[model samples]
Target: MSDVLVIGAGPAGLHAASRALDAGAEVTVLDAHDLVGGQFWRHLPDDRAAADEAQLHHGWKSFQQLRVRLEEHPRCRVLTGTEVWAIEPEEHGAAARVHALSGPSGALRREEVLLTPERLVLATGAHDRVLPFPGWDLPGVFSAGAAQALAKAERVAVGERVLVAGAGPFLLATAASLIATGATVVGVHEAAGPSALCRGWLSRPWELASSARKLTELAAYVTGHLRHRIPYVAGSAVIAAEGNGRVESVRVTRLDRDWRPVARTERDIAVDAVAVSHGFTPRLELAIAAGCAITADRFVAVDARQATTVPGVYAAGELTGIGGMALSAVEGAIAGLEAAGGVIPRQLLAERARQRAFAIRLERAHGIRPGWTDWLCDDTTICRCEDVPFGALSLTEGATQSLRAAKLSTRAGLGSCQGRTCGRTVEEILRQSPGLLGTTTTDQRPIAAPVRLGEFARE
Candidate 1:
């Protein structure tokens, strides 16, 4: 039996496994992808074998270095293209029982029983959160992250004319990348206005000099928009997308202080594609399945140790909460230290707390304002997966609410990309309604992708 089994090979899981191996524990790391680095740095074998190392995505370098270190450790085992379906307490005196599919099928499956290590760290990362509107289900519409992935990983463009929409730092980043890659950016839309900058400046003092450095990136990104002549439309959002088979045009509107759309202020812009996203939500499937306690907002809650309520289980990185890559690496290191039974220094934890406090303030400062969805007419689609309109889902006794209550509501979650694209819109809609906060959680599944029955039959 292995001494430690990390469920992900992302930064958090990699750090945890390294720490455990350093502490003389036998470790095995598993991931659903064929390579490490999770979403931030997804690479295929071709990417790994690329002749131009400098052309490799910056994010993958860290994962590549970690992969080399782990591979050289005789005590560690790395399993790629593996899915852990369930984790349960051991029946015998063993520490825990992990059930996983070795490949695509049940044929080569194994019940990995590990002598529950002193700790288990989960660094599953985060997923894009999108808000739905009219014609969102069209082919050319994708989350901003997906657009980046398509270009960076798959070397494919979703379309030639792309308009990036939504708020937060990611919107700017996506726009920059698309513009750099030869896409004709019609415009960039953000929900927040100049006031967001004022709030950011106020919290900059609290985070000290570090906050200033980060804000510089946002400023640079905005400046890039101006230099590119890509109109940065603030205090606005995409209200509707119109297209035949794919997105060809969209309605953008400026919102009032209360977030209501001004009448006759809507402007239409034609674009072959749209990359829209709000922000990210923590990816907590592994944590939740391992019985970790989730917070009020569905984020996996952990104390300073990065240990979850479940004994021997820990979470780090965006799984705990979304910050950037630096925060994730620091959180992972702290979790690793604690998991290895080592004491984390007070100064280190203090730094994390300080940065985290500032991060919370930043999130609130730029968070989706109240009544933002008032821009959506009753006819606008709320659940793009099922083509369920806002009014149909919002009515007091609507079938929408009924499906949600019965947990039979795939309308919001069952799209081509599953719930990754529209889960937040559903949550926001529900949160707007009274008494609906704790109704459900993201569906916990063993494997996130479809497993072919033939692969399951493989030995």
Candidate 2:
């Protein structure tokens, strides 16, 4: 029997693995986290740790069930706390060479699995998008998803007063979690204005009931915010943050339809911490390194069957783009069915298409506003890894064109995190500053994570 290697343990990865196993392939699922569920449907220590159904999304409950189902499969093997650093396509043999590291032991490991009947699935999800503003480097600043994780997994409060700033569903989910956990939401700032809801409504009539369901979900969140008396500021941006050491207060302002912050509407809201996001950029290190074609969103581009341009490689979930967990699960199943040489169920394929269409519409309507680069004054830091200032990158020759040029000039990409946090922001700043945007593609590296030298020597 051929072995299939699925590189992720989230819904997409697990779904693909389950399909492969059902089709008689020996499947091994690898993940960086110790647990099976990815960020969306995390497995907390106990059920009591999480909030009631109203506050939390329903997917979390379903993911919990998925975990139990995956565990019962005989053809499946789960490897958690493992990192896939590099992958070499097979030319002579039918198998691909995968190089990875186990997180806890820091040991390098290698596996060569066949590529024919043994398919490769890239379900490596996404990371939160961060926009750099003054004091973003402050100690108390966290991503919106990070705050939910902090409370759910680590059992710690991010802060008493927190600012949740961003655009999209994650912003609402994060704010709800924080408020339910007793954190005072000082203010919620969204880059998109009332136009976002209008666009959502306009699309609903054409999309049938799907659009209405999404609208209702959004309305419920808005109602919760209103009931709690939490102020939701739409068409706004967090221009700057100020504090001695940690975050103290943030400057916010009204934004025009074109995303330019209005000059006269500036206001400063006091808060001990800030949780901000724009959207999510696909975590494409492994996919790009493996030579998959990337789209404008920096997500690994795949066809209807979740197959990448590279043969024998399949991709699913947020790594394809941040379409949420339900979409990911459906995409995963479709990918797995395709990988196993089985016909995708007609119902599942239709569902995937509907969800994909909805995701694209949402992305277009709530697209990142312009003038976000305004947050980064010349003095603001862009590369948090190396503490490189926007001024430094702007001055460096050819750094204004793209991430690749900036990396060449300032060593911006040469960091431990591999520019995951700062890459999108740098690209946006570069595109806006001097009007130099050559091509939109993620920087691909051979190794996604660091590997011990000894392992290489031994090989």
Best by lDDT: 2
lDDT of 1 by residue, 57-164 (tens): 444566677889898899888887777655665535433566556554444344332334435667778878777777777888999998877765565667798988
Query: Please, what are the lDDT tens digits per residue for candidate 2 over residues 364-395?
Result: 65678776776567778888888888898888
Query: What lDDT would each prediction earn against the true structure?
Result: 0.70, 0.76
Off by over 4 Å in 2: 45-57, 92-95, 103-117, 206-208, 211-220, 401-405, 433-442
Can you give the lDDT of residue 423 in candidate 1? 64
**Cα lDDT, model 1, residue 305:** 85
Clashing pairs in 2: none
Worst 10 residues of 1 by lDDT: 106-115
226: Cα error in model 1, Å: 4.9
Q: Pick by TM-score: which candidate is best?
A: 2
Q: Over the full model, what C-alpha lDDT does candidate 1 score relative to the true structure?
A: 0.70
